[model samples]
Target: MENLQMLMYGFTVALSLENISAAIFGAVLGLIVGALPGIGSLAGVALLLPLTYKFNPTTAIIMLGSLYYANMFGGAFSAILINIPGDGPAVMTTLDGFPMAQKGRPGQALFTSNIASFIGGLIGMFIVIFTGPSLARLGLNFGPVEMAALLLLAMTSIGWLLGENPIKGIVTTAMGMLIATMGMDAVRGVPRYYFGSIYLMGGVPFVPLVIGMVGFSRVIGLMTDRKSAPPITERLHYRDCMLTAHDFKRLLMPSIRAGLIGTFIGILPGAGATTAAFVCYAFEKRFKSEEPLGTGAIEGIAACESGNNAAAAGAFAPLLALGIPGSGTGAVLLGGLMMWGLNPGPLLFTNHPDFAWGLLASLFLANLITLAISWVVIPILVQVLTVPIALMIPVIMTICVVGSYSVTNSMYGVLIMFIAGIIGYIMTELKYPTSTLVLAVVLSPIFETDLRRAFLISGGSPAIFFQKPISCVLMIAFFIFLALPIIKAMWKRMRSSKGGV
Candidate 1:
């Protein structure tokens, strides 16, 4: 009943014309950014953050949220048409989406992707509306120990999930952690890694590093690929992209299931859309026994699209509940919240019910708006792919440089972006996953500060990590996550030996 009332209040706030308009604009821009390589929703939101400083808190949040979902939609465009993934989550879509496009059904592929995204988004929104308060309360209970363990779990993700080479992921994570230490020590107030440079006093700026790592790195990589292929010139047919009844029947169940899975994963802090999409793809492969998933299966496309979009909505849950960001894009939204002189969390619901609820309510309208726009413009959007690399690279580079500078207007930002670009380029060549490295970069600062704080508060005792039941449980969970794969591998080896004997 309380939830219902909060949602009702939220709807009232979201109904305003200004908020509505922001959602549409954000969704559209996000789509365009997501369609292009090297310009993901993370970069898109980071770039646009400056513009939102002028808007009201509600309007800024609505716009930022819309952009997030729109990016999810746009990611499908590259995955289907160019066999490229603009974001980590979209990688799953390329497995089947590209093949579907090549099979002369590009229109159908677009249709399913949009519809699946819509369905997934709705599911995630439903969860937010109905269970958000409870989730928020749970989030509030998390302490530094639990947070540390959670971050540790997130760090291990690099090793276990990023690529075939676990060592590279571990090395990348360590490098990020080490770099995060450059700022003043949270406990001692002495700068450890700044190396006496005044510019390093405040530490590496996050926006520049991220923009460089995720955006400029791709620009550099694409620079080398420009000579290998001519520009894409395939035109899209908008009228044919509408879903048929048959297509709807085939997509509905998978879309719904994927959305549910994605939303659940999103609610779990640090599990973003990328993980959701990957899990959905694996689920599709495992359960759909007779069907080959990576071979243009419609189910695969549905799973990828639905899971990623739903995860976008799920990412918001933490922001609303605990004032913590669950993804990099969520971090940008956090900045917007700070800019507006409005903070998120449980107190927000009490002091600013309209603001909190309104943001949540805006999502429903945003999803519908995205679906409508995608349906009408998908065919036209195809032309974006044909943009020549020479033209596109410079434009993207301009945006990257500007975005980095705008974060704090520091010249070192541009330098960091360039340095990150070089690092990114080298990492890519070495078969390292940028996602893992970026994740570590984003989380390591918070992890280091909090870990040090927790230790200081506990009089330098490591056992403080286990003093709280929640933290102990989380520590146990971390060990379990670490052991699962090793145990399975050992079990498989033993079974093989027994069979051979």
Candidate 2:
């Protein structure tokens, strides 16, 4: 009941004209960013981040949140129409969405995905509203030992899930930790990797590095691909571009199931929207649909779209309640919170009710805004995909350079960002997941801080991690997730050897 009252007050703040405008603007911008290929939410948010440093923290968060959710909403447009994923989460949308589009029902695919996205997002918000307080309550008991164990779990999952091989993931994670060790130590006020240079005092600038790695590197990679995606166009009447009453009836249950699935997976640290989408689609595949999946089935689109959108919402749970991010974009948002002088976690709800509740309330409104605009602008959104990638790359590249420069008032920042972009491109070429590196970078400081604190509290006893029940559970989970891959590999090798003998 108290949570309800707080949320009601949050709605008042969110409905204010200024915040509403921010939400609308973010939703529109996010949709545009999501529709652009290779410039996923991570880059989109990073590119726009420097602009928010000047805004009030609440307004800044509102805008960023709007962009994040709206990007998920807009991602389906290109996925359904052009068969290219607009964002990572949209990959599954292509399986069935594009098939539907190819069957001359482009509008139907768009409408189904838009509707599913809306429902999924709503489900995500409710899941947060219900679970956040409980989690926050539990998080209140998390001391250094507990938090350190949990951080380990998060880092392990990020590496294991983001790529095919865990070894590459661990290598990137280690590299990120090494990079993070650069700059002055927060506790000692002394440089670890500055090498007598004053400029390295601040360590690495996150926004600049992320902008280079995600936005700039993506642009550089596309510069070589050279080939354009399929052109998409449609003659539209209002009816053709909208979901029919019958279609809604067919989709309602599937979207709901996916919403739940997405919310569950999304709340787990290091799991992501892409994973949620795939999981839900696979889960739902056991049911009979009007059309077989991967064959233009609306049911498949519903499951994928809803799951991803819901997962986006679910990702916020760990981020808000534990100050732990589940995905690359979640890490970026976590970084934003720190920059704004706001700490995420259980205390945030008490210390910064306005930021927490206002952001939550704004998310609800952002969904409506995204859905309404998406339906009205389906034709316009579809046309965006047809813009030559050749033309878009240079323009996006210029923006990224400018965005990176704005992060630090130095040309040196630009140089570092460009170098990071090269590293990102190389990582891509070698099939080493860049996300693991970003995940490692994001978690390094937190993990170090908490582990040091735990050691201090435990009088230098490493067994402190196993002493607490919660920490023991987390540590066990961490080890299991970490060791399962190696175990499976060994089992496979043994079986192969036995067969050869």
Candidate maximizing lDDT: 2
- Give Cα-based local distance difference scores for all models: 0.78, 0.87
lDDT of 1: 0.78
Which window of 10 residues has the lowest lDDT sum in candidate 2? 229-238
Q: What value does the lDDT take at residue 257 in candidate 2?
A: 96
Q: What is the TM-score of each candidate against the true structure?
A: 0.86, 0.97
Give the Å error, residue 448, model 1. 4.0
The C-alpha stretches of model 1 lying farther than 4 A from their native spots are: 186-192, 229-231, 285-295, 322-328, 331-352, 436-445, 480-501
lDDT of 2 by residue, 66-163 (tens): 99999998888888877788889999999999899889888898889999999999999999887887788899999989989998899888888887
Predicted candidate 1 versus true structure: per-residue lDDT over 436-471, tens digit per residue = 665666567667767877888898998988889878
Worst 10 residues of 1 by lDDT: 157-166
